[model samples]
Target: MPRIKPLPDELDPLAAQLVVRLRELKTHGELTMRRLAAGTGYSARSWERYLGGTSLPPRAAVEALARLTGTDPVRLLAMHEIAAASWDIRRAESPGEHEPEEQRRSEDEKGERREQEREQGQPPRRLPHIALTAGVLALTVAFMAALLLVLRLDENVAPAAVATPAGTAATTPPHSYLCRIARTDGRWSAGINNGRDTEISYGDTGTDVAEAQCLLRRAGISPGGIDGMFGPLTLRAVKTFQDRAGLVVDGMLGPRSWKALRG
Candidate 1:
């Protein structure tokens, strides 16, 4: 027998938006979907589904595309949300209560039978308590499995903290910082201190160093590209900005650096 292929999942508006963005990027770069799939570690068929808006692309897939295209994932996520919201609204307006008439009749018949049994001056039928217990146990096991999967995904996807310099005491403020950053269509915004007033794009490489570079550039500091890789250029720019702002010149972009950048 020939192997059967799975049907494509129906595309919702949000999925459609994701497809559009991915296609736009691919077109501008003159790359094919197969090329993207190969580069991103996603299967070509899966890429087709993702670009066709037939399904939501996994977070990893989104990140891979962003990185490959040298674009930011944050902005892409915002568009996804907008599309999702519109899809949700349309669903709400449509008729979702489509229970089969035969199924309703079957339920009514069962209810009548129960009532009739009660009227006969006899004890009501006892449901199989064991079945209910077994069901609960099965549900609990399934829930636990799902929880574990989510935890694993988080562990894998979450960014690790940047290593602080050695000899930095625990009492001292953490050497590395995490900054909230935003990007839209390859353009990034200035970073805000304490994640406040910061409209971060989803799945952004939200490392503090990356945020610092974005802020630096916005403030005319221009600490090189927003590659999320902190290097000597970034450090030099941070120290220069710190000196001008009369803050500690540790060459680390911290709270003081953030404040100075914002100012």
Candidate 2:
């Protein structure tokens, strides 16, 4: 049982997803880092870095891992391509990279070269060993287009809350509209909240808090008793749910928490 570090929120989601898949493959194959290295040409140190998400493995390394573990290569390769692009974007955006004038010039030069090559109508010459990268990029783009297709999470989303006069009772909200997917199971149907938004928190006793607890139950998390009180039990459950959902894990049922629980 190797201890795996919890992935922080700062990690790029695309790269994070690939790291998750690689870990699964490694676990299923019952491989140590040394074993993985033996099965692939890459070093065990490289596997450590890749699995830790400090580095993205090369395409061939990804393919080798998939073969050794009997995993499908297409999806992993597509994800790897996306992870690489996204990782590059993150590095380019980092503040430290901007502080170095030399680094900035290098990036600008690379960008200019690419633009010039495109303008010249010169097809990218491919080395046979890495020729598949182009195809992988195309597949990754198509895959992303499908996955990132945007539809409203809930057609009946509540309108933004209006300012209320002092001492007026706030309106109870419908489920959070921030559910991860556009589609949810029928039990978690979406409607509208015509009322003011109410945040459900621990130590709070109200019908809205109770409803939030029930929604948590629907999401397969137990928040102690549904007594409408935000107690420690409810707090723990909220944090657990947030962590699983890659949320802030702050134990507060904000809009995103509300949406995921509602889902």
Candidate 3:
């Protein structure tokens, strides 16, 4: 078994927790990445990324681990959901990124509202009445500041396992953890790397062809062996895999076929 890499410290606290728990369960089950791949249909390399926190594990991976380790799927799945949600929110909140168009529009609307008030002479009236309105404005600002502070504190902390309603927390549902994978940018980390789209056919031999062969073999259509050669056996294997993958059954490996093979 390969040595496990340390979980990334920079991961969102919730995601870090999920990865740590997965590592504990994987160790408790005494299953190597190879055995896990054999049992779960995910590649050992995929498990490496997932457990190392370099990539988020798919829902199927989570469920498989829960089943193997006898952990409460409901709770683990909730953690997975919260972790995934944090990943998305972090990406959205990346510093110095372009402001969302909707938010930009919202700012413009606020400016327009302020301008309208000014044109209506409200500013003048408010200026003359500042002594009366000052206390109200100060109180409003203080309240908003306190509210923002609390919200920011919440953002910095990891969410609890249960939801609080009526001041009581209950376990979250497993389905609540269900979510879509991050954008197309996350595909490579998800084991769906489609970097090279060269047309690979018979006699085309290299790392690219070998990867295709590996994916084919994993799908139970052996390409003779992973010798990095696109020989006759490899061609037949590609066609067979394409057929099963609902592809065009072309002997050549292209983008669509590569996507199917990786997935």
Candidate 4:
């Protein structure tokens, strides 16, 4: 019998999740690092590093594990996503790039001294009231100009005519389809609609749904495989989504309420 290698001590939350998953698989006799190494032609040391959270596993390693364990690669990939996002957030919050309190205070003092020198060298500046009034006038003019420009642009940009589905009277409220929705453009847009038009903003759809589902899963709603489908799994996902979006617990996807979710 081969001994299972231990994970690294510095593992982040994501790495820790992976370790938990691996341990579950081990209990189920689904995989062992030595077995995985033999199957994938990777060294046991490489397997240890990949599973230990010291390094990201190659896509091939993930695929191989899925095959060996009788698990969906897509689901495994989703797990990796959670880990990566957690790592990114941790990196952003780390104090490595922050200035010390003394350094920040010194910089602030230097800026104040420079402003004082400029004030002493120059003639008394115009009254702040006059300056503020002029600034407001300039901003109003600029806003008017921008409004006109936007109106002109709208005129040039043709709108797509989404014809109502046949036999569905335009006067009747648009048939409410069950969908798994997520926030986009400060509105809640559907992630999964039953083979209908689910218009998510470009560069927003897949990644956002994956992230939202990841959060929902942590909150105890299983969103299936995060494949952006509005099926039963995603409907289960909506209860959690609604709670986070501050909507009534009802699962119906109404336009006004869904719009609030896009935030």
Highest lDDT scorer: 2
* lDDT (10s digit) by residue, model 3, range 110-194: 5797799888878332233556456545654554454344334442244445444484335432221111123254332112223
Best by TM-score: 2
lDDT of 4 by residue, 1-263 (tens): 45556665656755576556655554454455665677567788887766665666655666556544434444444455455555544444443423433354455775787699798896533434766557655654554454344334442243333244486333211112234545455644444432232333212334444544444554566765554333334554566667777887565445533444444
Q: State TM-scores per candidate.
A: 0.31, 0.39, 0.37, 0.32
Give me the displacement of residue 82 in model 4, in angstroms: 1.6
Pick by TM-score: 1 or 2, better one:
2
lDDT assessment of candidate 3: 0.63
Worst 10 residues of 3 by lDDT: 174-183
Clashes of 2: 2
Deviation in angstroms for 191 in model 3? 45
Each prediction's Cα lDDT score? 0.55, 0.64, 0.63, 0.50
Ranked candidates (lDDT, high to low): 2, 3, 1, 4
* Runs in model 4 lying further than 4 Å from the true structure: 1-9, 30-32, 91-263
- Model 4 compared with the native: what TM-score? 0.32
Candidate 1 Cα errors over 4 Å, as ranges: 1-14, 84-263
